[model samples]
Target: MELHSHRMTALVLLMAAVALAGCRPEAEVAGGALDATDGDPPATRTALDPAAASAPITLEDVMEFDPRYLIGISYPPGMERYPGLAAELRRYAEAARAELMAAVEDLGPSSEDRMRAPYDLALSFDLLMETPEIVAVQAGGSLYTGGAHGIPLVARFVWLPQRDEMLTAASLFQGREGWHEVSAFVRESLHTSLSQRLEADALAPADRFRLLASGGEMIDEGTAPEAGNFAQFEPVPGVDGRLRALRFVFPPYQVGPYSDGVQTVEVPSAVLLPHLSPEYRGLFAAG
Candidate 1:
């Protein structure tokens, strides 16, 4: 599940209100009013090349509202070759910018104490996998809004090149039953990982107790293999470059305190083959 930025949520609600009033905001390009700068320019290419494994997907900065907030957006250069997918990526970046701006507005005019330090907002995307069949991107970062700490988020976008469609967590499974099995596997993996962490001698007894208490909530089905909970995942590849396991990602505070940082666990494809739909089962099968 993706965490909607405050601004994105507000914008959606505002749009809905406008719709009820029979009006709408004029559409704008991806960058909107932000002053764009090539923060980390990617490699220049003459054409779309999905198979270009070494190609760079760089990030660009939108600093029009800097000192108040900052946003970084990017789209892989060759994405335009796939018009629909390119549009989706552009829209995603634009939405991220809207969220950052909305966050700044929600803070209102900064006061002297608030002005002591500038608010921070950042969004960036990374291409995690680029197999011929699928391409996966991870988009997320931290946002601070005059709080005790900033909230970090991570989301995954998997595109099926052959189908020219995006894959949701549910779509990757066989059916409702398949999802349930995957969810159970995720919960068990989390429990095992967390137990190992707690048993480590590095942590103080009090810290371990606190973690255990706070992390207990994560053990149930509610926090298990639902679409939202497992939004960020990737296929783990073996030495032969074949898919071996499915790795699920969990950002901090998702399953434990921030101090615990991000957590990840992988379930072997072999173990999940029975629960996978025919379409993906073959892809995950041993090479």
Candidate 2:
């Protein structure tokens, strides 16, 4: 399930806030935002060529409705094969791109921090140049037929920028280290974005909450004549004694005049484990 609109919008705003706040130090490294030159190889056009690989796929390319998800093209011999792999590839790629866009836009302008402007610019530039890959991680064992969880699958895409050269997922996940890696990127991005927009003035709190509440009210209206729902998050304790929580709220909010009438229903961790990205799942499993 997708995140409810209000939360999505709020999270986007919060993520922007955090990115601007400089909460995490490794954002530059994890997001590949600070390791490239001004003229690093531009995002190639090869992704447009069906027979060519190594090209970066844009979010728009994967959003098109089609049976073939990988830009309506097939992978070459060397490309790894997996069931429903093409579709999953597109989904993850689009998701990754969307997150990247959100992260970048939240960064705002560089005038706020003239000294760090170059760092922000470097991150933006590297993001454009980086290519993310998807990897299939086994879920270990299954309960029913002893086979894998077939219908819903999980996968991981380790985003290793050629410039930074991170060691590996194992190295990153050593005692909350992996999550710190991701969080760091998000933090830096948030800090950069926030520092720039600090003096812009805050939105009206009353109006903002009212807008979200109205959206929630609309969702309540749509619930059944007798049924009801509530928002929540389910936490799954990690093997390493840490808790990995997955919170699934309502569908993303549709922006409009009455968009404020929305409510989000949270899904449990067990329900979401099957739906997480492979990379996300691996980080928890390793913990």
Give the per-residue lDDT of model 1 (tens digit) for 40-86.
11111122244432233333334333556544343433454444445
| lDDT (Cα, tens digit) per residue for candidate 2, span 1-287 | 12223322432343343334334332232221111111111121111123222444332111122111101111112113322333334443344344334434444455652321111110111111112322222110001111111111112222222322221323322244333333333334333433333324454767655645664444334331210111111223444533344221122222112222211232233433443446455434331
Off by over 4 Å in 2: 1-79, 87-209, 218-287
Residue 257 of model 2, lDDT score: 22
Question: How far does residue 69 in candidate 2 sit from its true spot (Å)?
Answer: 18
Cα RMSD for predicted model 2: 19.6
Model 2 residue 200 lDDT score: 49
Highest lDDT against the true fold, candidate: 1
Model 1 bad stretches (over 4 Å): 1-65, 107-117, 202-210, 239-241
Worst 10 residues of 2 by lDDT: 138-147
